[model samples]
Each structure stands twice: as structure tokens, then as C-alpha cells.
Target chain A: MTNENNSLAEKKTPPIYPVKTKVQVSIIFFVILGIYLFSMFWTQKEMVGGFSGAFENMFTVMEKFFPPNFGVIGAIWGPLVETIQMAIIATTIAAILTVPLAVLAARNVTTFKPLYYTTRTVLNILRTIPDLVLAVIFVGLFGIGLFPGILALVVFSLGILAKLISETIEAVDMNPLEAMRASGGNVYQVIWYALVPQVLPQFTSLVLYVFEINIRASVVLGFVGAGGIGLILNQQLGFYNYPNAMMIIVLIFAVVIIIEYISTKLREALI
Target chain B: METYSLPPKPKNSLYKKLKMIIITLLVIALYVWTFVSIDIDWGRAIERAANNFQRVIPKLFSPDWTATGEVALSMLETVFIAFAGSLMAAILAVPLAFLAAHNMMGGKIFSTIGKWILSAVRAFPDLILAILFVVAVGPNAFAGVLAIAIGSTGMLGKMFSEIIESIDMEVVQAMEANGANKIQILFYAVMPQIIPEFLSFAIYRFEVDIRASSILGIVGAGGIGTMIIFASNNRNWNEMGTILLAIIIVVTIIDFASSRIRNKIV
Candidate 1:
């Protein structure tokens, strides 16, 4: 190696990271890694058997999903429609609610530090609770139905939609907004005439993305007695109706694919 | 003064105007349809939710501190599940990412196939994966771990592949020019650059998994979710409040800690 590197080594300096802090960083990394390993060892009392075991279990379980019973699709119409409806309603409501929150949360728009940070922290708290947890809490409050599910979906999507739209708002060109303000425009006029035009397209796209998320999330919410196709799917799985479950999964896959394709095209058109 | 003559107003095409009107109408119709589909007694629902809040709000404000030890244990279990699962997924994702990365792999077909497979895996939500694992493993901490792993794998694989494809290829090319073997080239030229982002992503995923794993217990997958549901069943509002508070605190702490690390790394 010394013989091969002899010519260039003298002329070219070796690239190095910040070596002074390297040792400290390595120690912290190792300590964290050690803690994780220790915690996992303390927690696991079951057989994992690594990759080989995983493959075996996966294969055996997967075999039961073959030859999906398409016959059950007829009966699943109501719930499927119900799931779509839940997403539509919730997404529309969240999209509406997120507009104001996103503007308020955007640092450039709000200008006030306390208001901005508080909006961010509140958004974080809202996002940290996974949609399924929201559904669980809502379902607990009001028995299982589309109503609870819709409410959960609205709150869940609101947090994310607001966050994304706020970032978009922050990134908009500021000159127009500045011009409006310089002309003595009120806050509402500045937002409507200057800010709205720039942010509208991105807002619509984010809404679409949120809707896509809601569809997938609604399915999971159904597992916990919130109304949707997932609820039916869970019931089938609980009953050990593998063939029926397979059909529902297939239907969901198809719907998700179609919706994603359309949304992607629409987003491409917007951007 | 420049616009004193009143510049011609921008013309609005009739087609565009009609299209906008139609789109607005369609949006309204869709909203109406969604409302009709989810039939609700709104007045009753508002009354009921308000009443429930009256009973639940106080407990939420004053969490029952007695269950701190139990809450701590469950929180630990949640952290372990996220850590082990995300680590496992990160390790497994490396090879799949190599296959999917367009820069490393010349064959387009295989990369596309890899992408499609990842997307299919992604479509299956984490909870469903947990439910599937629970069916096989009889519901435990391990099942939750496995579920998180599978879900993380889908996302991590795609993200890692994108990272791999976007990396500066000059170093790798230089290593190739030096007649290094494939493994040596990857380890020497690529691994150094990719590790930081990979670590950042894994930590981010772990934070999300902690929140996710808590709810896995609702389906008997193991976490604090079962406690919340249990307290609700028993009408022990205070205990439920305590668990929710515990989750929020732990989640906030993890988010704060991880974001700091991620910022330093990236």
C-alpha cells in the first residue's frame, strides 16, 4: 500500500473529519447503542431466530392468503364506501382548518415569536399522537361508528396538513407581500391579495397528499372499531377468514394505487 | 404615472371561467355526498362529547401520579421496541437499497422492481403488520418489534436507495480507478458518506415507532395502549389521564433529544 500510494501521497493531503471532537462523538454513539442493545435484551422473551426464522414464519402465513375470495367483494361495498366517505369528509374539513393554522404557524407570516413557537409546539403534540391513538380515544368517547372515525381523522390530518402548508407558506416569495404592506394594505389584504396567489397551488397539493394519508390511516382506525373498510377487515381477520381478508387487502391495494397515481399526476401538473 | 392610461385588463376566457365554476360546484357536491354518507345526529354528538369532556377534563389536568412506576416500565418497553425494530430494519434495508439505487446498479428493470416492492410493503400500515405478527406470535413485545421493523423497512429501503443514487459518484469512481474490489470501494468511498444520513433517518424512524408501538398494545401487540383502553373500560378517568400524560412527556422528550442529534449529524 505504501509503494502504490507513494507518488500522490506527498502532494495530496488526506481528507479528515473534525478529529478533535471525533472521540467524544464516538463515545456518545457507543453509549446510546449499548443502552438500546441492553433494553432490547431486557424486553424480548420470545423467539425471533433472525432472518431464517422470519422467512419461515412469513412463508407459512403468506400461504394462507392465496386464491383470494373475490365473492366477498359484493358485501364489502358499504364499508368501502364508508371508508372513502370518512376520508373525504375529514380531509375537506382538515384542509379548511389547516389554512389558518398554517398561516399563523409560519414564522414570516406571524412575526410574533411566542405565537409561532406555541403553534409549533401545539402542532407537535397533535402530531405525536398517532391517528390510531386518536381513533382509540374517540371511539372510547363515542361508540364505534363513522362519526368518531371522521372526527379522529380530521384532527389527525389537521396537524400534518398545517405543518406542511406552513412550511410552504414560509418558503413563498416575500417581495409581493412586502409591496402589499408598503402600500398600506391591512394584514387580511396582504394575505388575500399577495400571499394567497403564491401559496394556493402548494396548499392544494398538500391537501391531496393529506387525503391520501387519511385513506390509509382510516383503514387502520377501523381496526379499533372506528367505521371504515378496516373495521370490516379486522372483523374478518378476527374470525380467521383469511380468504375474505385477502380480498379486502387486494381491494385496498387497488384503490390506494389508483388514488396515488391520480394525485401524483395532479401534483406534477401543479408544480 | 406609468399606468395612467389604464392598461388593458387581463382577459378571462369563458372556458376557464366555466371550468372554475364547474370545479367549485363539484367540490361542493363531493362535500355534500360525504356528509350524507356519514349520517350523524350532530346535536346529540356535540352534547355527548361535551358531557364526556366535563367528566374527563379535570382528571386530564390533574394526572394521577401514583402509576408513575408502571408508566415508566411500559415506556421503557416502547423505547426498546422502537430501537430494536428500527435497527433491525436499517440493517436489512442496506442490501435492498443497493439493488434499488440507480447509480450503483446499471439495470433499470431490477431497480424498478425493487421500487415497486418497497411501495407495496409501504402500503401495509404498521398496525396491520402488528396484527399479522400477533396472529403468528400470539401477541407480545416481539410482535410489536417485528411489525415496526417491517413497516420501517419499506420506508427506509426507499429512502436509503434515493440517498445512494444521489451521492457523489466521483469518490466511488476514483476507488474503482484504483482497482479496488466492489466491497472495498463501497466500504471506503460510500459507507463514510452514507452512514450519517442513515443514522439520522433511523433515529427519526425510532421516534415515530415509539408513538406507534404504544398503540400496538390496543391489538394485544404490547405497550401502554392497553392500559388506556382498560382504564376507559373501568371508567378510571384519572388513570387514563396519567397514561396519556406519560406518553406525551416521553414522546416530547424523545423528539427534542433526537432532533438535536439529527441537526448535529446532518
Candidate 2:
């Protein structure tokens, strides 16, 4: 390499690549990699059956779930509808509530530094709480019913919806809002006529996306007696009714796939 | 000639105005119907909502500090499970990702099959996957690990395949022209380009798996989620507050720390 660059040496040839930086980069990489590998090894040793044992167990388990009991589907229809209803109601509330919070949280919309920081911090903490814990807490608070499930879904989806909408607001082509303001439009008029149009598409798309998340979340919330299809599934499991549990799983799976398909199509159309 | 001044805004046409009102009404009706259909004790819920605020928020400030040790240990267990799961997914997803990518797979049938499998696996959420594993392995942390790995595979494989499909074909063509073997081309051409992105995706999945494994406990698969259930069951709102606070703190710390590391890599 030195020989090839000799002719340009007197003219101050730059190094082809920064050897110093490359070494530093790899050193950092290896250190992180080392910690990650050690953690994996420790966890594997502490838990999990061996690979061969798991394979054997997997096969045995396969037999238990085979030809899943479809008979239980009829019994679960009411609870399944309850789960869907929980998602729909929660999503509507979250979408409606996100409008003001998202606007205030957005740096572009709110120049109040303290407000942005406070809102951001609160949202982060909200997002950090696992949805399961939220469900369990709500269940305990309000007693077991669809209300707690709906409430949990509201808070859970709010964290997601607010974050997404705020980012969307920030990324909007600021020109339209600016144009309206320049035209002497009041704040409400500017937002409604200019900013709303720009973000309407994404806002709708994100609401549909959050609705999908809420459906799955509501099912899990039911496991903790929060009230939905998962409650029945958990009851069956606790009673050692594998076939019934299998049936519930299948029904939920079908619903998830159908919802996912519809949402995907809707999202694509929005774009 | 004087420049024309901006015209006053025109009112929305009656048809458009009526259409807007109809849409708004329809949405409100749907929301109301969904709310009313559920069998809920709204009176109790509203009553408890106020009681819960009085009962819960105060406890959060005085978090039962004694439970911190137990909570932290289980939080570590959750992180360990997530680590193991993410690594497993990273290893398991590569070949499947290659098979799924149309640009790499070459055959429509193979890629279609791969895509279908990914979609099927992705349909089940981690908590549901945890339930299946609990039944399989009798509710150990290992079950949580397996569940997380399987869940992560579906997503990581799909994202990986997408990245592979969008990669520059020119480098691959050059390598093939040089008479490189399949493995040689994969390593010398494809791997170099996608490795950074794959790492980022895997790391991101690990962060997500941490949040997921914590909740896997509700179904008896493993982790701190069971702590919340237990605390709630015993009507120990203070203990529940402690558990929740621990989770929030731990998860936020990890999110920030991991994101910083990610920035260095990508």
C-alpha cells in the first residue's frame, strides 16, 4: 500500500482508510459481542432443555395439538365477540385522546420546552409498563370484566398511538401550516384546514394499526381474568382441557390473520 | 395592473358537508355500539376508577423497597430469556430469510412457501406462543425462551428477507462472474452488505423480547409478569405498584442503553 501511494506521498496522500478508526470500531464490536455471547450461554445453561430433548418433547407435544378440537368454537363465540369489542372501543378512545397529546408532544407544534420534556417523559414511562402488568392492575382495580380489559387496552394503545402521531406531526411538510398562518388564519383554523389534511392519512393508518395490536393484547388481558376470549382459554388450560384450549387458540389465530389481512389492505390503500 | 388579492374562502359544498357529517356520525355510532355490546359493570368501573387513583398513585411513591431485590432478580431472568431467544432467532432465521427472498431463492414456489410460513408464524403473538410452550415444556423459563425465539424468528426473517431482496444485485453478479461458489458468494458478497442491517434488526428484536418475556409469566411461561398477577391477586396494591415501578425503570434503562449501542453499530 505504501509503494502504491509513494508517488503522491510528497503531495500529502490521505490514508486509503482510517486504520485507527477501524481497529477502534472492531474493538467496540467485539466487547459488545462478548457480553452478548456470555449472556446467551448463561441463560441457556440455566434454563431450556437440551436441543435433542426439546426435539423429542416437541414431537410429543405435536400429537397433543393434532386435529384440534373444533367443537369448542361455538362456546367461545360470545367471548370472542367481547374481545373484538374491547379492541374496537379501546382503539376509538385512544385515537380520540391522542390528538391533543400528540400535538403538544410534537416539538414542531409545541415550542414549550418544558411541556415537551414532561410529555415525552410521561409517554416513555407509560410505554415502558408492559401491557400485561397494566391489564392485571386494571383487573384488580375494577374487578374482572370487559371494562378493565378495555381500560388497559386504552392506556396501552394510547402510548403507541401518541408516539406515532407525534412523529407524524413532526414529519409533516410544515409548509401548509406555515401558509395558513401567513394568511392570518387563527390557530384552530390553521390546524384544521392545513395540518389536519396533511396528517389525516397517517392518523387513520396508525389507528388501524393500533387496532390490530389491541386485539391481540385484549386476548392476553383475558388470561388474567380481565374478561375476553382469553379468560375462557385460561380456564380451560387450568382445568387441563387441552382440546378446548386448542380450539380457542385456533379461533384466535383465525381472527388475527383476518384482521391482519384487512389492516394490511387498508394501510396499502391509504398510501 | 393591480395584482388580484386573495379571494375570500368559499364555504364547503353541501354534498361534501353532508358526507363529512355522515362519516363522523357513522364512526361515533360504531364506537358506541362496541362499548355498549360488552357486558360491563360500568357503574362499578367508574366508581373504582376514582378509588384506584386514590389507592394506587400514593403507593407508587412509597414503593415497597423490600421487594426490589425479588423484582430485580426476576427482571434479570426476563432479560436472560430475551437474550437467549434473540440469539436463537438470529441463527434460525438466516437460511429461512434467504429462502424467502425472491432475489436469492430464484424459484417462485420456494419463496412463496417461505413467505407463507413466516406469515403463519407471525400471526401468533408472543404471549400466545408462550402459552403453547408452557403446555409443551411445563412452564419453565425455557418455555419463555423458546416462545420468544419462535416469535422473533417470524419477524426477523421477514425483515431480513426484505433487506436481502432490496440489496444491490451488481455486486452479486460480479461475484458470480468470478466463478465463486455459492457459499463464497454468500459470504463474500451478500453477507458483507447485510450484516450491519441484520445486526440492527436482531438487537431491536432483543429489546422487544425483553418487554415480551416479562409478560409471558401471566400464562406461566416465565418472568416478572407473574409477580404482577400474584400481587394483584392478593389485593396487594402497594406490592403491585412496586413491581410495576421496577419494570418501568428497568425497561427504560435497557431501552436507552441498547439504543446507544445500536447507534454505534448502524
Candidate 3:
């Protein structure tokens, strides 16, 4: 009877707050805060030479990009088209290649654990390096041209497209695949009739996403003399031809918006 | 149920069809044409790559351990820049995301404006933004951080808004049905479901930010990337090799750690 009364009293009491855990969390936040403050001061000191002068001249620099030169539009059209084409070609090639690579990489599809991991690791490392860096290296290897840009895009987009598509494959219904296998369907047939149907929408959407990224990346690649509007933009910037640079920037902005809108709509429709 | 019987399958494959054959041939021809147009000189490229490897391979093995201190200091800045930038973006993105969510905003105008802002910011690649900021902010790490923050806001806002749109509306409705205010409902109901996704995306963005910050130094925004470009310009392969080694090590370590954290969060 006394034990039962004590248990009832214990249940009625409110639980105490964990003050130590709160303190620990606070300590972590403070430490991070301190580090951030220290880095800010250090960077400020290091950048002393050019730092203050930049802000002072900001107004003058802003003047240059204004009232963008509309006349330079015609001149940039060809290179702009070249840039779009490069992206299209790269996206197509990468999308096709990614299919086989993605299939071989997906753990459920491949069943070869080691091969799956190795391919996945390759894709991860490939994705880490910036597309611009790849273009720069390829340009050095192959000489300055569009070829290097396309190659870089192919390699870069392949990494992204493969990873995304492989994940989609992993998320697919396993029952359908099992049924296909039980019926003695070959690997190709299983993929075509069962796996492909399930993942096709995601694949197309991912391809389009990669294409958008490739377009932006290709423009930058052109800056390193890889042959696109970026090459022209870089030249103008190099010569301090602000008017021409302004025009290129405007055109780029417009093109990017249109492409993004179209791709976004398509993706929405697919999904 | 009645069982249906079919005729025996054809011996020939689907590729034997005239339309399929034509389509395949056309695709191959188009690819070949693009390949040729791109002017990829396989032989010359192979030779040059071989020569580059010969120069790079030996130097890549050796790192300047003494310079590790300086590199570490710079790396701290890179990390802080990424952290601070993403934090800033996360803070800014919350309100923008709320406004951008169609279900929440109940108006197309605001969402359209939000989306336009996002796309405009995104259209200018981080590299270009870094360049512009470097020019504006004087080649400082502050510029790097701010540029990343501005660019990141675009992506974060878009993604966060989408996450909001996809959330189960019942929970939100329940909160609204109660005496809770907008802020209270947001905090108590909408946030819990979206927190994991938000954290996952933020951490992934941080990883990208690290890589982005590394490259910003190339445009004079200040980091070890400046060292790589310097070494490259001076033809100091040994120094470049050391920088590359440092980068590969640091990046790989961070990449591993962040993904682990992200995995736990999601």
C-alpha cells in the first residue's frame, strides 16, 4: 500500500529540465561564433590593399553596366547559338552514356557490390571538381577550342546525370524487376520493359536539369577560350569594352530566363 | 478466366525494323557530325596529356608540409565564408520561401516575383558573381562570402518553397484551426516536417559552397585557389602540385564528413 502511494506521487511530479544539455549546446554555438569572428578579422587584414578602394569605386563600376548596349546583340547571336548547341549536344551524349553507367552503378540492378561502389565513388569524385576547372584542364590538354568545352561538359554532366538516375533506379519498385527476372527475361529486356518505364520521367527531367547546368558552365568555358559567347564577353572585359560586355550580360540573362522557364515547365509536366 | 495464346515470336530483333534502323543511323550521324564540328584532335590531345602527366605526376606526390600552416589558415577562412554565407542565405530564404510558396501566399504575383528573383540570381553563375563581387568588394574573402550568399539564396529559396508546397496540408490546417497565429503555426506545424529536408539541402549546399569558395580565389576573392593560379601562371608545377595535393586532401576530408552529417540529419 505504501509503495503504491509513492509510485502515484512520482507520476504526479513534473520532469526536471536537462540544464546540462542546454549548456552544452550553447557552448557549441559560442565556439562556432568565436571562430567565425576570428576569420572575419583575419581575412580583412589580408585583403587590406584592395579592400577599401573597391567600395569607394563601386559607383563608377556600376555606371558601366547601365543602359546596356543593345547594338551588340546581333554580334553575340552566333556565339550564343553555339553555346546552346554545345549544351544540347553534351546533354544528349551524357544522357545516353549515363543510362549504362547508372545501371551498372545501381546496387539493386548490378548486384555486384564492389563494382557498384567503385562506379559510385568515381561519380562522386567527378562531381566534386568544378566544371570550369575541367574545362581549363581539357583546354590545356587539347588546346583552346570548343572541343575541350564539349568534352568537359560530357564528363561533368555524365557524373551528375548518372548519380541522379541511379538513385531513381534504386527507388524503383523491386517487385516488377523480380517478376521480370523470375520469367527469365534478359537484363536488357528487364531494364527496357520494367525498369525503364518506371524511371523514364525522372531520367528526362534530370537530363533537362543537367542541360541547364551545362549551358551555364559552357558559357564560362568559353571565357577560357573554348569558343562561345563567353569568349566574346571575356575579350570585351579584357579590353575594357564595357558596352559590349553589358550587351552580352543582358542577352545571357534573357536566354537563361527563357531556358530555365521552359525546362521548369517541362520538368513539372514530366513529374 | 480464359487463357490467351499468341503466335510464335519473330526471330528478328526490333532493330531490324526500317524506322528503328533509320532513327539509330540518324542519331549516330548527328553525333558524329557534332564530334567533328567540335574539332577534338584525339592524337594531339593524347600526346599533350601524356606530356602534362609527365610533368605533373612526380610533383603531385610531394607536398610542402611547412606551408600547411598557411593553407590551414586560408582553409579556415574558406570554411567560415561558406558557413557564414549559408547561414545568411538560410535566414533570408525562410521569408522568401514562405512568400514564394503558392499554398501559403495564395497569390500568383508574389510567387512569380519571388521566382523571377531566384532565376535572375541563379542565371549569374557563382563564378561570375564572385568576379563581380571581387571587383566591388576589392578581392576580399568578404566578397566571396557575400557572392555565395546571394547566389545560394536563389537555390535555397526555390527548394525551400517547393518543400513547403509538397508538405501535407492537413497538419497546417489543424494548426490554423487552432488559436495559433501564423508564426506559431509555422514554428509548431510546418517546420517539423520540412526541417530534415531543409538541413539536408543546406548541408549539401555547404559542400558546394566549399568547392565554390575554393574557386573564388581564382578570381581574386582570396583563398588557396589564388596559390594554384599563381603557380600555374609562373609555370611552377611543383607549387601547383602541392596546392593540388592540399586541395584534394582537404576537399576529400570535408566531403566525407559533410555527407556523414547530412546522412544523419536526413
Per-residue alpha-carbon lDDT of model 3 for A1-271, expressed as tens digits? Answer: 8679768977997644388867876996698678767756766665655546767776677786677888888889978888877988889989889988998888887898899889998887777766765665566556677777888999989988999999999899989888999989998898788988999999989998998998888776776566678888878877877777878877877888889888889799889
Docking model 3 quality class: acceptable
- Candidate 2 falls in which docking quality class? medium
How many steric overlaps does candidate 2 have?
0
lDDT by residue (B1-266, candidate 3, tens digit) is 99979788877776568766896898698667665555446687677677776665566556656667776777777777787777777778888888888888878998888877776888887767776676666778888877888889889988989998999999888878866688978777888889889878877788778877776776677776676566555656566556655666677788899889888878
Model 3: pairs clashing at backbone N, Cα or C within 3 Å = none
Which runs of model 1 end up more than 4 angstroms from their true locations?
A: A1-33, A46-58, A183-189, B1-29, B170-181
| Ranking 1 against 3 by lDDT, winner | 1
lDDT for predicted candidate 3 compared with the true structure: 0.78
Model 2's alpha-carbon lDDT is: 0.84
Q: In order, what lDDT does every prediction score?
A: 0.83, 0.84, 0.78
Worst 10 residues of 3 chain A by lDDT: A42-51
What does candidate 1's lDDT look like per residue over A1-271, in tens digits?
A: 7666866774687556577578887997798789767856655665457446756876777778777998998999888888888898899899989988998899988999999999998998898787876786786677667788999999999999999999999899999989989979998999798988899999999999998889888877787778899888888988988889888988887787777778879899887
- Candidate 1 per-residue lDDT over residues B49-115, each given as its tens digit: 7878667667666778898888778877887888888888888888888888888888998899888
Which 10 consecutive positions of candidate 2 chain B have the poorest summed lDDT?
A: B53-62
lDDT of 2 by residue, A1-271 (tens): 6656656774696765499978987997688678667756654564456657777887788787776888877889999988889899899899999999998899998899999999999998889887778888777678778887888889988998999999999998988888889978999998788888899999999999999989888877888888888889888888977778888888888999999898889799887
Off by over 4 Å in 2: A1-51, B1-33, B49-55, B177-179
